[model samples]
Target: MGPGRIAGVVTVPELAEGDRLTVDGVDLRVRVSARRRRFALTIEPDATVTLHVPDGRPAPDAEEFVRAHRTWLVTKRAIRERTRPVNPAKRLVEGEVFRYLGRTYRLTVADDVPSAGRVRLVAGRLVMSRRAAADPARGREALVDWYSRVGYAWSVGRLQPWAARMSAAEPALEVRDLGGRWGTYEPGTGDRGVGLMCLGWPLFQLPMRLVDYVIAHELAHVRIPGHRGDFWRLLRRALPEYVACRAELDELGRRLWMGEIWWGG
Candidate 1:
């Protein structure tokens, strides 16, 4: 038995990925990044606090950073608590409404159909096989898959135009689940010559304008990595009304469904 041991089990303290620390009653998930030049903090959509530390930074320095920013963190958390969205869980039932690119379509469980094909939009209805509808997980997967496919198709056409307008290269694009991010732009590495942009499937549920805003926002990152003054200037050059679009996105994005399924008892 030792001071830092329990029942003959020795506990080793080290800084590594997925490390967690509690400072001033706030839980922080520690993440070390080589690309980061300084310490930064981000509040996730689920209200989880993440502290981004630069490679080689010590744990004590990270704790000091959190302590210095404690006031800001508290204010932000309070604001988030008041503004957090109450998005309802969706059920896999008939006539349940779903939105895509600002258009509403009701769900149709096709039992009479011979095969349970991939979810599709036929005759203005989102058709899902009865087999999938019977299972909540399958139904949710089918719907998200549909969104990813359709969103990718729609974004392909929109990408080039925005790229041209912003004087940025048209990088590789993907549509999928980007947890806590509507869009992300990764600069090209030595192995990959061109950058990559990934948009969350849930973003497709927003209006076309908002989708365009996200596209343009990521494209701006192609030129400017961070959201500094120069980045906003470049974005404004392409979209004069970008300020309004950003504000609207913040307000509307809170209400989007994040794949929560309602299991009817």
Candidate 2:
């Protein structure tokens, strides 16, 4: 079968939603940005296509551009499908294991109300109390709530010293389930306007050493906005073995970062 039109072709630059297209039966999500100078396309980590075209470019040009890259798109899509993880059994069950600060613990769903729904890594099990031990959905939500609280508190403690060490201003810190790569650093605009630093909740699930690496990496951006030689130099000064930590983070990417949890906040 020939490529199909996945959605109505987008014409106006002001249109708020992304248009869709199909080539060789592969679905693509097309976005038109006037700020672009040339055609750029990427298959996101989740196996979705994002095509950015120069502003004011017409629909026909976009379709043709996609046709030219059809081969690459098809190949990448296949690779993602091949390596995609089948959904594992509910991870919140009684016996599933999870990691915190590089420590592994079995999950224990205890219905002890006096614990006030607080979850902890105790003895050898990550224990949380809830009325329903059999309902995976409730258990997952409870765990996410717990992760958010602990993640934010822990991140603040770590970010403080790094900020002082770098002589960087203490920007507002927010930690929630952003569900993406490690975290992000955004420099603020004016004096008295503190910049904002956000840490993804998933990073909290990994080891604390890796967590510090991400925090330091973001803090480095406060001094060097771009990831150029200067940025690397700054980061290296803070963490002497940051290169090795980066590679290790990549190795752990598939196991933790690619999960289908709620990408909240």
Q: Which regions of candidate 1 fall more than 4 Å away from where they truly are?
A: 1-15, 112-117
Error of 1 at 105 (Å): 0.8
lDDT accuracy of residue 175 in candidate 2: 73
lDDT, candidate 2, equals: 0.69
| Deviation of model 1 at 190, angstroms | 1.3
lDDT of 1 by residue, 208-255 (tens): 999999999999999987678999999999999999998888778888
Candidate 2 lDDT, 160-227, residue by residue in tens: 89988876777788876664446877677667577788887767768888999999998988777646
> Best lDDT goes to which candidate?
1
TM-score, model 2 to reference: 0.68
Clashes per candidate (backbone, < 3 Å): 0, 1
Structural similarity to truth (TM-score) of each candidate: 0.89, 0.68
